[model samples]
Target: MTNRTFDEMQPGDRAELRRLITADDLFVFAAASGNSNPMHLTDTDVDGNGTAERIAPGMFMASLISAVLGTQLPGPGTLYRRQTLDFHTRAHAGEEVIVRAEVVSKAEGMVRLRTEVTHADGRQILTGEAEVIAPVEKFDREDVEVPGLVVQRHRHFEALLERARPLPALPTAVVCPNEAKSLGGALLAARESVISPILIGEAEAIRRAADEIGADLGGIEVIDVAGDAAAAELACRLVHDHRAAAVMKGHLHTDDLLKPMLDKAHGLRVGRRFTHVFVMDVPGHPEPLFVTDAAINIAPDLATKMDICQNAIDLALSLGMEPRVGVLSAVETVNPAIQSSIDAALLSKMADRGQIKGGQVEGPLAMDNAVDMGAARTKGLKGSVAGRANILVVPGLDAGNMLAKQLAFISHAEGAGLVLGAKVPVILNSRSDSPMSRLASCAVAAIRHFAGAR
Candidate 1:
């Protein structure tokens, strides 16, 4: 960085900078300025046009002028005296704009400059003038670095919903949707056209739940079943009869829901045991993160862990992701005393032998090395899945559950839970899940269902 002194300033001296507007920039600006008007937000449609314009805030364009004054032209140690702005047109996220400042005059230890911002196509967006006190002494220094910001947005889930929207809604048997949270979540997915829900629960309780959420249950199927177990059984029957393509847990214990599905005589079970996967959209992560056996499979043995890995890999492939499985353990190296490390090493070898298909599998990775390049490099680990693993296969249920929850609560990730390896996808959602989380679960199930159909 270099600055011009007041005495050295001359007419026609100019400086300019170009910036490409991004959706995150709008969010960051909104957060920093406390101006959350929908017009300046990335996900809002103020005109009822159904498309988000993501218009850049006018003040944001004006701020570019300040950037020029502080860093360029009168480069450093510049103090603002007065400024005037005139808006000509609009700028939006994803557009590039050039901000320019030119020296106009100097008097009374103050420098006046003509400032303007224009689109890359030569269309003017903002015209402005700035008056500032130029630095008395020449200033020169290295550029200062500032920390980057990541907006806590669940874009992965959003993309999943978008991909599922084009498919025919999956006919889902929602077992025991007798509470506001559960019923409302199913209905929300219905509204989004992700699922066509067949409500299987007590009619009166379902109606009450609809009332609580102010949701209309008109034209939607409602099967009256007295007990939770009965409703779950009926849902399983629906899947067996091919009336429903997916099973959704609603306001019922997971054990009750899966017990009927596990029946040998009449069940939704395939050969593989049921395994749970949480598809998480963590903020700032470049890709979706998958945690397996989080809600099921306690203390899984070698065979069960193989099923877990294969199920997760299948789910990832269904979602168009190339699975990179990281069997997490206490340490990156195998220790004979550490059962998890041994299991991880065995899983890696099994994957190499084509036992666990459709993924790059590596194991005995601590949590840090599994997802972080720096940690993986520090440990001198070299494998396709060592550092870039998207699917984290924990040693047991306890570890998987804790890791998923930590990402959800502490890392501010939104998760969509699903039970895989069944004949059909099972949408599993928690009572404490947000509406988006619930909807995302249904969306994931719908996508997986359609992908299998194809």
Candidate 2:
């Protein structure tokens, strides 16, 4: 550790830190700063778009200057007063850059420094001047490691918007929004242009709840139904009549809304069995995991599991992923007593025999083997979907629900729930879910609704 005091510092003293740029560095910077510009994110150079090559934000590179000043130059007890910077060129990814700061002048309490950043080739990128109040006393402290921050930039929301940009917002009927979370989510989605919500519930109660949540219901369509059952029926009726493109589960129980969708006469069922999928963006997972049957299909048999697997695969394809299915079990071996392992083996065979299509399937795998290649190798498991499986098809609803909730609560994931295999996608959000989660569900449903139209 280096420490510099005002008494020890002389004019023209300099300190420099050198580092190579990395993609993770750029991503972390973007995440921390909430800069979602495509020019900084994408690899392919947009031709004639008047943007430079895949570049990191100028301020991101300049932050290294602040780091050098506070941590090394005036060293730790320096308070940054002001900074003036000029960026000459875009600092791109994969380029080495050096940050240099030199003490230019020192007043009684204020110290001014000249700062500049240059490429490995000595091309100037940024030059700045920083004035700081240096510590007079020996303000000594032991060096500590800064904890890594999990900057969830909400990249999931951006990706969803890319798919949703061209399509029109879905006319969605939100069933039985008796509380703030449900009603507020729908209103937020509508505000974001993701869903054109037709709020279906008791009008006076809905308005009161909306007031409590500070959501304006003016100019928004609201169907005044007497109770939860009637609201569910009307929501289903709207979808069946093509008046609404989707139905969303609100404050009521999932069964309350789902029952109307299962009706033979007026339900939104096509020829396929309805199931649920939770799209999860876990912290360290390289890709989003499509978790299936988490909210539906309790203890499904082989045939029903097949439908569940196919439904997940279809959703993955809609999102432009050639999904590798991992049929998870307690252990990576078929046993006579454990029915999950048996079903896993059967699903694998079904994929091989062309009974289940549109995904690469491998199964009879424990959680570790399904997700970790090293674990898979250690267990002598060799298959395409063994380690790199992005879609997790759990044994039953209990297992799937637990796994998805663990990823959401324990790992702090961004989750969106949707019902697949229906005539229209059902945006499903729990009463306790965040507004962002609900908005994400609406985006997924809108994308699925438009994709289904094709």
Best by lDDT: 1
Q: After superposition, how far is residue 386 of candidate 1 from its true place, in Å?
A: 2.6
Backbone clashes in each candidate structure, one number apiece?
0, 0
Alpha-carbon runs more than 4 Å astray in model 2: 1-116, 119-122, 127-150
Q: Estimate each model's TM-score.
A: 0.95, 0.77
Give the Cα RMSD of candidate 2: 6.8
Query: Model 1, range 96-151, lDDT digits (tens) per residue?
Result: 99999999999989999999999999899989789999899888878677798779
Q: What value does the lDDT take at residue 251 in candidate 1?
A: 96
Q: lDDT tens digits, residues 372-424, model 2?
A: 99999999988788889998999889989899889888888878999988788
lDDT of each: 0.93, 0.86
**Where does candidate 1 clash, by residue pair?**
none
lDDT of 1: 0.93
Worst 10 residues of 1 by lDDT: 40-49
